[model samples]
Target: MEKIKPRNFFDRMQALDRRYIYLVVALSIILPLIIPFNSKTYVTEPTENVYKKIDSYAGRKDRAILMCFSHDASTMAELFPMEVAILRHCFERKIPVFTICFMPAAKPLMDYAIMTAKEDYNVQSGIDYLSFGYKPYGLFLPILLGMGDDISEAVETDDQGRKIDSLPIMKEIRNYNEMNLVIDFAASAAVYSWIIYARAKFGVNVAAGITAVMAADNYPYLQTGQLTGMLSGLKGAAEYEKLVDIFATHRDENGNIASREFSKEILKETWIKLSDIQDRRYKTARIGMNAQTVAHVMIIVFILLGNVGYFVTRKKDIEPTG
Candidate 1:
């Protein structure tokens, strides 16, 4: 009787149970969320541009950034962080901010973003920032156009039903002239309305915070200079979060603040640990990225191992017997 040979490591791996693979993949994703590690977030040019644009208006009462909540809860995971990071940037720098939504579904999210970011800062509503709240879709065009002439006259009252003209923030921010930048966070091409009417008509700079899948669709506008900047999905959020941590929020040994212009080279040496971030809400995108990165690496490893095992086992099986 011929002696049977024991299977080698490659042979065993080649036939590894699919359930085991799934188990490992799940763990790889879950473990990162439970215990996130320090990771490098390379800032991209588009994200940096958005940061620079907002940073330019830092501490300026006459200029404010408008965040248009054009999306609902469906794409919140990617878009919410972008809102929080931008709001945190604004709060830290004393930049005036305005939020508005044409859809009723976006009203809660607009409030939530403000609530999350203001927790760590001593910012007052209608003074530091304002919310235009939800308007009917039919009124979207009229409101967009009217903001160019007069913000208070457009929406009249804020989400709180207080006359916006009565608010202190409106003293300088009367129209899109003062609110120079409008960032529409959407899952679709909702930004076109802003670009066509708000930017083309009023000359307000337009940027976007959109889901990753829709990013490609908007790049043309960025190239044409119609879109000022964009936060593309979770990656964009992660980049903005890193920028906020570095320039806006960082403090030295003596408790002195550190603020500087962002560059790709500077970001290379910077690594942010999720545990170090005090605000749990601020760490959302980075934590999500950790899980995504680990899962991708795990998948790559499985693919490589499967390929190696298949080739090695095939070669050995076809070898002539000694």
Candidate 2:
């Protein structure tokens, strides 16, 4: 039998179409999962600044967090982790959450979020948080939120067919004026609706978790102090996971690995990373890594290969084809 080995390290690393780099990246993340590598997370100065300010207003009896989903399946890759972690934190602390959807389809998505939150933390449904389904009317959103008792009076059932009045969580939440914090997970400029009607009109505190593409625009809101805190895409969610010591995906009760449920008070430190969250965020509809990130890497790879491929082919061309 002939022994085979590459003469050089570069040759050894060459991968035709095997996606060995992806395997390596996957292992870099997955090994940590199996071994439980412990690394203390650094509080990004941005999150710290937001944390101190957000922490100040927490723990109020009626203080609530309103998280909005203004996106479709395509944007979920970057948006869901941040949304889930923020929701977990709010529910764990017994903070009331009134999640809604400006995009309308977000209504079902929001319900899925609530169900996961409840199952993960064993949270009480109405007492802990409530998703008001996808209210189809964007124009009335402002009035529904800021119009006080009028909003609650009109909203009869929650997304799950529960009577809004019967919910212990909603029994007293009469208006947007009572909301302590508003966390908007947005994609396009659609979230501005909540900004104009909910926060500006009622003076409710606001925060946000937005996709990387849309995050730049929201910085103005942060600068204006219209938003108390914000998480920009998957990186922000990973940072938040480090803050709370949980993973987006975790081991199941039977020891089979699975996506971690959202729990405000997570007992076991989870393996929640932006990558893991992406798995759940897209769920049945995901493909691969972040497209932009992938493109950047491909660009670099191609640049190196171009230089090498050019030299190799040129050498062959210069030499006579005998």
Candidate 3:
């Protein structure tokens, strides 16, 4: 009978060094960031619903989209991309976008998204878009209620201290009737306030853009129609980006744009006219999706290998001796 080596291949795998797995994972994540790969993302119902709602308001001057930034830097990694996607959609379709931040820390992020998303486009402040800046949380509820009556009085000035009522965009946007859609982005459960106060009182449709970990908590609102739709975390952001790319930019997958017929129907129904227009900027969430996918795959591979080693080694130990 052949003798087994003191440290056989199976034994080595059973006791594999943790450092090796760590190195593999690190490389798996880093390589995707370095390499530009075309990854397809599946659009979920919740994310698609948000896109559909925004698309429904395309080229409409009467109804505008209000983006509420209620999160700080801690959740920016997941939520910021969502902001950019929503902004790009609005900009592409020429929908007037209004932004407000209640949390002081969220003010900068609000500015960052506007500044970043407006770079390639000719979007100007007080004209195409407006930011209400940082309002105290204590006063936000009152301001929310007041906006239903008079937006200019509620948000007295833009972030730059300019009179909001004096802006070109504000002339048509008086209250929730004009600015109908409200999408709240938060790390915590800030959408509840928007639901209870903004939707409950004013009768405006509400939606949420949140991190995946916090997604489950908001599903109840989504189901009840309190939230018209939601974008849940990075995956949601990526899906929105894909939809934008497919509709506005005419980005095709290997020259096959009609691979997803559902998206085509959405484009037709939304009446988004495709032109030679292209967004030359890097799609952050799509790129980040690559890294996330690779990391997850690597972890699953490691887990499977560990399990195989455990089971194989156990079989050897359990064999009867002559």
Candidate 4:
């Protein structure tokens, strides 16, 4: 039999500072973003549901789909990954995406996201996809949708100063009439603008990607089938990452590695590659459990140490004022 004593001096000496734990948490998130993790995480049923919705409305080579980026730089960190994942799948499936933005400031965001996926997925611009650049429609998009006219006349050239009509992708896309799906990734209410114009007037099918906070705002639309489907925030992004077969070293909402440490509780394990079900379940269930795990463990240790110090001080205080 083996006897155990309290944590030894050497063991205590080896303990990590809570600040170090914070660094690990920060690095776990930032490191992946800074470098190309390119993990192969599998998508879930709900994520697949969005793809199925996209496919349901997609067809005809000239009929390009539109992706509206309504979120600004603040959300780029959380939303961009989901943007890339969506763009990757769409382009890989040979879907031509016409990127649009309702916010002038968001155009760069649209461009950054579009260009990254285009480069990474080998998606060619002016053919496979485009940035309709930014348009200042104000509230008239619904009127333009009904008109089925080129909104490009409003912004003559793209961000690069190239005449949009000259771009090959734009050559096929004139107005909402030429679009099949409107995939709006938003952090604002600009999503409703698409609903009015793209769906109501143009009769185009709609899909969306938004932060989890904005997600519930879209549910009634989902129920009414006004929006075909949506991916809600980073959790949604992780799910999409799985379907597209990209995995990184970071963990999910739970402390689990963004993928299965081993092959257990996975369906289609032989065929479906990258992330497995069990890996995402805990994180998704607990909501930032991984982020909290490293923090909470350290807090508990500090509290225990604080209690020990308090007890020792109490003994001295009872003996004398000194």
TM-score for each model: 0.85, 0.64, 0.82, 0.62
lDDT of each: 0.90, 0.59, 0.82, 0.62
What range of 10 consecutive residues in model 1 has the weakest lDDT sum? 257-266
Ranking by lDDT: 1, 3, 4, 2
lDDT of 3 by residue, 187-302 (tens): 88988988999899989989999988889999999999999989998888887877776664444647643222236466435432212224424367777788999999988987
Report the error of model 2 at residue 38, Å: 7.9
Model 4 per-residue lDDT tens digits across residues 88-142? 6666666677676767778788877776666645666666776657767573454
TM-score, candidate 2, is 0.64
Window of ten residues with lowest summed lDDT in model 3: 271-280
Superior by lDDT: candidate 1 or candidate 4: 1
| RMSD to the hidden true structure, all candidates | 4.1, 9.1, 5.3, 10.8
Model 4 alpha-carbon drift over 4 Å, by segment? 1-46, 55-60, 137-147, 151-156, 246-322
lDDT for predicted candidate 2 compared with the true structure: 0.59
* Clash numbers, per candidate: 0, 6, 0, 13
State the lDDT of candidate 2 residue by residue for 1-322, as single tens digits.
7545324434433434557656655655445444442243334544444444444434565656567677777877677665666666665555677776656667666776676656657566677777776766654565446344444566666677777777777655666656556667777875566577666777776667777787888888778877777777666665665554343334567955443333434533433344454334322111223333444466678568757766665565588644
